[model samples]
Target: MENLEKAIAEIKQALPGLTLLEQEPLAAHCSFRIGGPARALAVPQDVSSLARICSILKEHQLAPFLLGNGTNILFPDEGLQELFLISTEKLQKLFLLPDGAIYAEAGVSLSRLASFAQQNGLQGLEFASGIPGSVGGGVFINAGAYGGELKDVIESVVCLYAPDQGLYELSKEQCAFSYRKSYFSTHGGCMILSAVFRLQPGDREEIAAKMRELNEKRRAKQPLELPSAGSTFKRPEGHFAGALIEQAGLKGFTVGGAQVSEKHAGFVVNVGGATSHDVYDLMLHVRKTVYENSGVVLEPEVIILAPDYKLEDKGPRVHGNIVTVNGPAEE
Candidate 1:
């Protein structure tokens, strides 16, 4: 407790202007709307401010979690007492380059990016129109939908590598994007600052039409009305996770307020007042049941976090008829 207080005090002293929220409720930040209060949360206004905050956290040996819009993560019900959260939501900046590319900060929402692309008459970003995450989170998990992905249009990414506290630019290839995976997944220390997306000139009307079409599809299939992380499981190899769950007779399955959406088996929605433990237990049940029904193991796509949480064994754990696959699925 003393160390935590010291760290918080030092952070405020170093970055006087940085926005600080003490004992901030994390549920207010995440899309799932389920989580306890965080010890301290920092919202950096810009990239330079984010860098300074990161440096200070590092100097204090405090490893903060970098949050981007919080659309695809699950915060523990017990809350994060030790880890300070740094939200990039305020770092939003977007513009079109004269050469027909879009430059966006990590905090820029995918929706905004898609709109910006349409405004500039740029194509190739229509697929991300309804994605609820910020650009940084999108690139982190190589977010994709409607047959388009960040890897398809990204030219380069500006990252703040935490090891040296230095900024570096990585080309699209260097991003190591592959099937909802990226270099950021393995290297948790690096922070994405901004990205330059290479897009082609196209008809604005056509782009709008495409976005509308995709959004309609999303609305029809997804349980958008409920509070839930977008997709609960990654598309398993050669099989869709949703289909597998449906086949396993797990649709509409409930564990407290958390339930596998009958509207979309791929999603686990919080009906009302769901706790993080509810969601986590439901995920474990889904994975185990799906694995038992079919030989294939299902892995969670939602980024789950708690201060003392540790990755369990990846191999199947047999308990009665349920077989749990503890490995991470593709984002």
Candidate 2:
């Protein structure tokens, strides 16, 4: 409460254009449609506002979570403590740069990027045509689909380093992209603002055809109609995590409103009004059971945020056998 007030005051003083919300529900911000409330939510409209918000958070000693489209996160049902939720959803901007490059802000959605690329006869981004995350979020996690990743297209990224100065730029190499990680995920000094993507000119019809094919694949393989994070867990080495879970006979396993998608064992969908805890417990069960049966510890792809539990110790408790169920089974 004290920190919230302090943060609000500092933000008002520094960035007058910023909007702040109190006790904002996480369900409204996440794709999972669950979570209690954030201490405060701040939406910065521009680069200057974002920098000032960052400075205010730093001054108030509060670490705000940098949220994107909230397409891949699961918020806690118990809610978060005193923290600010910084949203870049409105910072959307795009430009067709010379030399066949696409420039986009962090808030720009992948769908928009894909559309723009297609319209401009650009190739190499059709794989991300249906990805639900923002460009910044995509870059933060090296988001990928259909054998392509943001890393492959991203030439450089511009980030704000308020702790040091105003803005900084990092090349793709500097981004330190791995499977599902980047420098931003590891080191916390920078926040992505915009990025430059190098694309090649291709036939528009071909790009559209490719996009259509990928979308069809998703429609067939993934449960796109459900409220769920796309993938529940990362692909463990030597085997598909989903195959293992399905083989363990855990598909359609429900905990409250959350269910391991029968269509795709990899996804945990909110069949109804599933709470964060329900999904969390289900993921834990899947990881533990998979490890016990096959000795492969599954890692979740979805990021969980809850006030009561830290990310470090919230996963993997029961493993040996199925225990007493907590939530109701899906019909």
Candidate 3:
């Protein structure tokens, strides 16, 4: 406790405008609303502040986790310890360039980007209308949805990296984007500052109509009424996670407060007061039962940031291009 407080104080001196909170609840930040309190959390007001805070944490050997919209993570019940949570919620800056390009800051949400594109008569980004995450997080995980992915529109990304010194620009090809992966994820030391996307001119009404169509589909098919970390697992080769769960007859399966969504068998929703352990246990059960029943194994799509009660069976994750993972397009 004393160490965390001292860290917070030191961070405040380094970053004046940024706000620091001790023992901040992770559940409040996550969409699932399941995680326990973090040791400390810092919300930087802008890019400069964020960089400064990062530098401070690194200097103190207290490297923290970068938290975005919290749409794709499940924190543990015992909570994170001796770690700092840095939020970019306040760094939202969206603008249109004179060269028909859209420059968006990392903190901007996909939903916001979709709206901006539609309003400006931009044809692309229609598939990302309902993706609930920030640009950095989306790009970090290569978020995609409705047949469109981030690599489709992203021309280049400007990142704050300290390989030599300060931030630098990396082209689309340099990003090394792949199926739900990126260079920033592979090679550390790069913090996404912003991105420039090339968009085609189109009718505003047409773009709006497309956005509405996708949003409607998401509402109808997904369990929007419940809280979940999007899809529970990635689509394995020649198989779908939802279908596997359904075939296993584990739809609506419950573990404590966590229950698989009957609306969409792929999702494990928090019906009421679900704990992190409950969700983790249920996920493990789904993987075990599905593998036992069938030859295929399921891999988790949602990232876990805390310790689990038991270790997940570690083996080769089923990988191939036999299926598509539906998600919001990346920036």
User: Which candidate's lDDT is highest?
Assistant: 1
Clash count (model 1, backbone only): 0
Residue 42 lDDT, candidate 2, scale 0-100:
84
- Residue clash pairs of candidate 3: 144-327, 144-328, 145-327, 145-328, 150-330
lDDT of 1: 0.84
Q: What is the TM-score of each candidate against the true structure?
A: 0.93, 0.91, 0.90
Give me candidate 2's TM-score against the actual structure. 0.91
After superposition on all C-alphas, the RMSD of every candidate to the true structure, in Å, is 4.0, 6.0, 5.0
Task: For candidate 3, write residues 94-154 as lDDT tens digits.
Answer: 9999898999998899999989988888988998879998898888778898889888889
TM match of model 3 to true structure:
0.90
Cand. 2 Cα-lDDT = 0.81
Positional deviation of residue 138's Cα in model 2 after best superposition, in angstroms: 0.5
lDDT of each: 0.84, 0.81, 0.80
Runs of candidate 1 exceeding 4 Å displacement: 1-3, 309-331
Quality of model 3 by C-alpha lDDT:
0.80
Q: Candidate 1's error at 114, in angstroms? A: 0.3
lDDT of 1 by residue, 1-331 (tens): 5666787898799889989998889999999999989888999888887888778777766556788988888888877777777899987889987887889999999999999999889999999999999999999889999788999999999999876898999999999998777887756677899999999989999999999999999999999999998998888899999999999999999999999999999999999999987887788888888998998887667787743443355234322111111222223
Q: Rank all candidate structures by their lDDT, best first, as comma-separated numbers.
A: 1, 2, 3
lDDT of 2 by residue, 1-331 (tens): 6976777777777766668777888889888888888777888888778887887777766555678999988887877655677899988889898677999999999989999999999999999999999998899889999899999999999998645646778999999998877887656656789999999889999999999999999999999899998888877777888899998889999999999999999999999989877887788888878888899888767765543544347656422111111111111
The candidate, 2 or 3, that scores higher on lDDT is 2
